[model samples]
Target: MSEGHENAGWRRLFGGDDLTFGTGFPLTGTRESRPDVDEEMRLAAHAEDLGFDALWARDVPLYWPRFGDAGQTFDPWTWLSHVAAHTDEVALGTASVVLPLRHPLHVAKSAASLDHLSGGRLVLGVATGDRDPEFDAFGLDHEARGARFREAVDCLRTVWSEEFPAASGEWGELDGDLDLVPKPTTETVPLLPTGRSRQSMEWLGDHGDGWLFYHLPDDTLDSYLDRWREAAGEKPYAMVVRTELADDPAADPEPRHQGYRAGSEWFVDYFRRLEEMGVDHVLVGADGDDPERGLTRLAETVVERV
Candidate 1:
């Protein structure tokens, strides 16, 4: 119902409640290692061929060994642009980008440019920096990220939707004399606020085009969905689930990280349950020795079936 949902990428992902699927980056599940680019590209294209609706890239500005994840080992915008060239139709997403660490001008320009080049296929998920080291490295006060996050959201919307928009913030000042050009392919890109991002549900619901949440227990997730419906109306609800499809179609699921390790049979049922509960999209952090193969298997069994 939002203006930006008119964009092709947004419509593709949230057009229905059948629970569309996406694959997350760091496909190899490596914490400290950089994945092979060629193979990643193959998988990126493969995912689209397999009928996955989107490919998500994470923003890891620096690999804090303590954190143990390097994301995709490429800048989200650049890597997504490369992926945009490799595949057609599938949406491009940032799982998300750390907002407090970068200036909104950069985010606005980069996001708008990607949306332009990708033919309106960009969905920008934004968040406050997750790691304290990133805040220090960016020379920002860690305590002020919540406020900065709000300002950055406003700044991005202002710049993208207005010509020569004037605004001021801790990041910088924008005067009406200068305009940000190459506006997005839609009214503006649909922004999905990642996690809480230090904001209350009311704000996330009011401001974000959608919500990106993490895996949660059944009762907890149901509660979240209920609250989300109340706060966000029919705006989409998307979440990440760790999926590792085993060779046995009947294998049971066990808890891993924020999601589950299960057979694709279970996953089909799992996803249906999510869809019934009003989830619009599900991003799979699929894990395996050969993640590409696992993705294919999941698509064959779960994505197609669900």
Candidate 2:
């Protein structure tokens, strides 16, 4: 809950009470193929210009036909770094990086490097990963992901915050003989656990800097927020909603998978409700024929008005 860190990006996104908006990547309509790098970069810069608080990138190491979504179709570290260089001020976040799939040392190194490079704009959302096929492909035990997740988090915190030659249980042994260079601008990068990650609510509150969860109904969201407050005690809570904005300003809401298909008016009211319920940041996936137009419309109609 303390904002004494050097990362201005973290301060800008989570340091206030007003609801903030962020857009998911791929900033284009291409779902099955890779997005045009130039177009995505342009839209990313445009989003920053439009006053979006953050830009989210996903980690999808491999594509699965059943999963159906490629998720920005880029390596999250590289993509965030590229976006970091293109825009200034807006926070750059990973919608999530699958921690159990990769080594904690590598993740810590890369994340710290990015934090320094971007002047502390990185917010890392990590998960145990949901894809069964990915676990098989990686030659990892899907069932053990939860345990691995805990260990990886411990490793990250130790290496980022403690002095060189730190020793972590089971994660690895970092002898004082050598050190991980380029520590984060802050004492530690903000780590937000996506969903439960097979962890208890108390554990999340104690360990995570914040919580990143999926969309929920009004009643459910309220209950969850209440529990989170009891457990996490003012730690930030973020959610993602997949929206398809309508052209009509007065359009009502129609439910989608986890979000809604609605007009600007409904969105404005919905966001206000979320703010009232104490939700911190909302990362939006505004799906439409013209993704850029969808982003601009939300920025103008919903973000500005709210």
Candidate 3:
């Protein structure tokens, strides 16, 4: 909650009440092989050209085949840094980082470095992590994630804002002698806790700079927004929408995994509805065989129209 104005990324994406658009990585997703880094980068540039507000990266440490989905297939920090170098003004973000699995100092250092690298264009979406197998692999207790998440949040805030900050937690103790350098462009990097992250709504309101949530139904979202606004006043709320655009501009929509398959017209109206409901930003994951095509169409019809 102590970031926005000093961070251009936060201002651009979360400043206005009208919903802004951003695209997640893996522009064209892969099935059995790794995604094409070259082409993905190409689309990233094109996305900025198309006026996309932000470029989001996913954090998938190890791909589990049973999950049936490999995330962007890249480490979020390195990947975003690469993305930062390639683009000019477009914001850079993490859809959500698994805080319990990584050290808070590492996260703080990486995020601060990236923020400086990107001209303060980083909005770190953090989570407690959902995959159970990941916890076992990392030698962590699954049930203790909530506590770990809180610790990480505190650690990051402390190290970034205070010089030689002292802290002790599940990760490790940071003695008051050594300090983290290359402090973020702001008092601290903007952190938006994603999903529930094993945390209560009240806690999110208190700590988060903002909130990042997955796709939700209209009725459900409205209800959730009611709760969110009451708890968090003026703090921005962002959500993802999985969409597959159709060739026909007026084509109807059908439910997909966490979103819908629809034409530009419907997508426009859907976004308008979200904007009206007080949604700040919408991270659109182009869901289909050819993501660039869907992206182009969305930019033309939905983004422009909105």
- The candidate, 1 or 3, that scores higher on lDDT is 1
Candidate 3 ranges beyond 4 A from true positions: 1-5
Candidate 1, residue 239: Cα displacement in angstroms equals 0.2
> Candidate 3 — worst ten consecutive residues by lDDT sum?
1-10
Q: What lDDT tens digits, residue by residue, belong to model 1 across residues 1-306?
A: 666677778988997657889988866666578888888888888889999999999999888988878888889999999989988999999999998888889999999999988988999989997899888887889999999999999998899889998899888897889999878887878999999999999999999999999999889999998988889898899999888777788999989888888877888889999888888998986677877788888888889999
lDDT of 3 by residue, 1-306 (tens): 343345889877977656888998877777335888888888999999999999998888878888776677878898888888889989999978999999898899899999999999999999988889999999999899999999999999999999998888878887898999989998889889999888999999889988999999999999999989988887889999987887788999989877999988998999998999999999986666667776777888789899
Q: lDDT per model, in order? A: 0.88, 0.88, 0.87
- Report model 2's TM-score to 2 decimal places: 0.97
Predicted candidate 2 versus true structure: per-residue lDDT over 1-306, tens digit per residue: 575344767787888889888988888966567989899999999999999999999888889878888888989999899998899889988879999898999999999999988888998899999998899998999999999999999988888887775576555787777677688898889999999999999999989988999999999999999999999999999998877788888888999998999998999999999999999999987687777788888889889998
Residue 20 in candidate 3, Cα distance off native in Å? 0.6
Deviation in angstroms for 286 in model 1? 2.6
